[model samples]
Target: MNARDPSLPLQADELSGLADFAASAWDEEIVPALTDYIAIPAKSPMFDADWAKHGYIDRVTRDAAAWVESKKVAGLKLEVIRVEGRTPVIFFEVPATKSGSTDTICLYGHLDKQPEFSGWRSDLGPWTPKYENGLLYGRGGADDGYAVYAAITAILALDKQGIPRPRCVGIIESCEESGSSDLPIYIDMLRERLGNVSLVVCLDSGAGNYDQLWLTTSLRGMVSGVLKVEVLTEGIHSGDASGLVPSSFRILRQVLDRLEDSKTGRLLPDSFHCEVPAARVAQARATAAILQDEVWKRYPWSCGADGAFTLPTTTDPVEGLLNRTWRPTLSVTGVEGFPDLGNAGNVLRPYTAFKLSLRLPPLIDGNEASLKLKTLLEDNAPYNAKVTFVPDGRAGALGATGWNTPELSPWLDQALNEASNAHFGAPLGYIGQGGTIPLMSMLQKGFPKAQMMVCGVLGPKSNAHGPNEFLHVPYGKRLTAAVAQVMAAHP
Candidate 1:
């Protein structure tokens, strides 16, 4: 598009120029835009059923699409694609600079966010943007509202330095936090348009540390739903029902016991897990050696009365990494059927409901796992209490599937190390993330041979999806430059 010579390789000085360009863009444009973005409550459709009426999702999507167009990158075409009754996606493309090159690079990110979680520091609410000590703190900033902005910055950085890159396309969706339910529709519509993808740069992932570029080698799948157990039609006086009624809370616990081991925190179903690939286990061991005890120590632990901090389930770094990345786990995220503590009374609750979230290994099918989970929790109710387990997502698409990246090509492997050394002065790191990115699996299947550059700014203590989440701005800048370098090296 720039009419620049594509044969010339990026020199050391040019890489520096790319970094400087990315830094300037982040400071002057991207940061301010993300600050405004963080202030919007663009909750995903799953979290906000009235998302269309709320207009937050539309607002952010519109704003991001406008920003891309305003860049005025030569030969770049942008569009906000929409299907009836579905969330929007921002699709854009730039013609390849390399003459006769048909390879395409797909850049992916999402704009919607998790619901505002409690427990933020008094000064740092999810909707309030605060920039301090090179970190931008907010709800979606790290988990990845910064991705779309960073992706563009990477492309622009290459153009600014006259570095010829492969044809590039961007797909920024607004439904990722909701298991990317609407993305498949858009993908089907845009299949022919997204031609011959060879490299995928996904910014919706995590890092082992901020020192180097972290490539997410794999991701865990997820299945979430509400499990409810009801024993009575209405609440009754505790004095009258204590001895006569079987407690719904107790019955709920019994049902959960069927799924998880309380003491070890392991899922009981063998089908819910898969044997970790030997290659992944080897990578985990190498990553564990690099991270050491920080794997478990990075978490914010509470202190006990004796002045000692709470211990993690395991202190061994290898086990810690494997437990989180390769093992199936269950979490009770939310609960209902209880009154406020301040309004405590002598009443026995009629029913108890828990929002259950299950994380599955990468190879497992999420839909299959969700069905198995439902049967395990709902079959033969304890105390004959009415029980139901309704999995989230559309009927056939009841869970978010995980992805295991395809093996890196020889050139890509060298380029990753080269880019990391150029920008961060460190070699690239490989690690499996515990979170799910639904689009990755779809893209992997859609383009079976695409080399994935799944990296992001969500590093240690970023706390994505939790309170006080923040984006490490410095890391974001370096990652942008690194992406440019890799795109330039595509062969």
Candidate 2:
């Protein structure tokens, strides 16, 4: 419907008051629900085939919506939208209080979590949420379970002070980790109800650090699938067929060689890369300068006997950052048909599978990239063997267009900076995150004119998608305050 403005601008005193409310809500409400959420193990559709059958995702969506409804905010409309077969989306709206306004703001997040990874320090586990030293260690907390709370906290915080804001609609789905395959369905079904969103806030992204607000300028696309190769009909004894069998693993390596160089660790084909935008390169250099040693130290580098491998021989952090964020890279994330060391035997295998995950530059095309990958790996197979590369996420293809920076209004920018400086004594940090958020491209296409403000608590040492992943408690509180401040100042 119509919207009215809050006091037009958020002041220093308002920020302090917002922070106080945020801290209290975080301690009394957010933490408890998030802890319970972590324990559920609501894995994405991609990771958990039984997600629908198990019903954990549905529980997460409904429980989360009910919790928000439990808050009893004024004019709040909440519901758990579920298609017959697709995953659920927690859809809700907070009607605008002010008059003569039609601007709608869409806030987004997801409930799905990545699978539990290895290596947890202290008494930590993926499903067991532990609060220690201002950090909540668990999966999905920072990578994004906090978004709905943050967005609602902002709205409620503003509402508590009688500050009016634009009508806010939120959609937190259960399929983000699975390339957001189900999200577009929700978007399409609710397109008319969503209205013309003037601004969008995504709290599922990366940050340089916890010192201040960080805005993601661009996101690299991703192409992932399983590459399987088969040779003989069955496993053969090494003594009987070692020489003549031509190991299947060797053939798999040959297929990979067509895509990447095993020696220098570079993508071999030119089809996978694109020229980095000059401004992005400059931004990378600036971000590198700001982060300094943090650019490399953020990673958990190993120190083995002969000294751990050097970080790919970059002359400076800027080159390393650009190479990582704006360049296409290939990583073999998983493998099959190989036994563990203790279970190993002197035997040749019939087939081998390498799980392929390739990151694409912002300007590259994922559809074209996947086609090239399938062609390179499957065509002209070593011995005309059965090999397949399947893109297993959404639309029969795990492809996403890279998102460019959206234009931000001056008022919005001012709100973000003021919020950052007030909540965190440091200025806002602007950087490009290397990870993929499956919905960025879709949202940009749908809301072509909306100003996208991507912020999150996934800072250094948060270890998202890895072991010991955590949510910085204080940072989340402040992030909520920031969102509130932005909401208060929305045009």
Best by the TM-score measure: 1
Off by over 4 Å in 2: 1-8, 307-315
Task: Give candidate 1's whole-model lDDT.
Answer: 0.92
Q: How close is candidate 2 to the true structure, as a TM-score?
A: 0.96
Cα displacement (Å) at residue 8, model 1: 4.8
Error of 1 at 136 (Å): 0.6
Q: Which residue ranges in model 1 land beyond 4 Å of their true spot? A: 1-8
lDDT for each candidate structure:
0.92, 0.84
Which residue pairs show backbone clashes in model 1?
A: none
- lDDT for residue 451 in candidate 2, whole number 0-100: 87
**Residue 37 shift from truth in candidate 1, angstroms:** 0.4
TM-scores, each model vs. reference: 0.98, 0.96
Candidate 2 lDDT over residue span 1-491, tens digit each = 22324555656676788999999999999999898988889999888899999998988888889888988988888878889878999989888866656999899999999999889876889999898999999999887998898788888887887767788999999898878878888889899989879888999988898888888888888888999998878788889998887778888888888988788678888877788778777878778878987887788777768897456446478877877778778888889889999988978888899888898887677777878788888998887778889886675555765677776679877888888898998777778777888677888889898888888999888999999999999999988988888876776
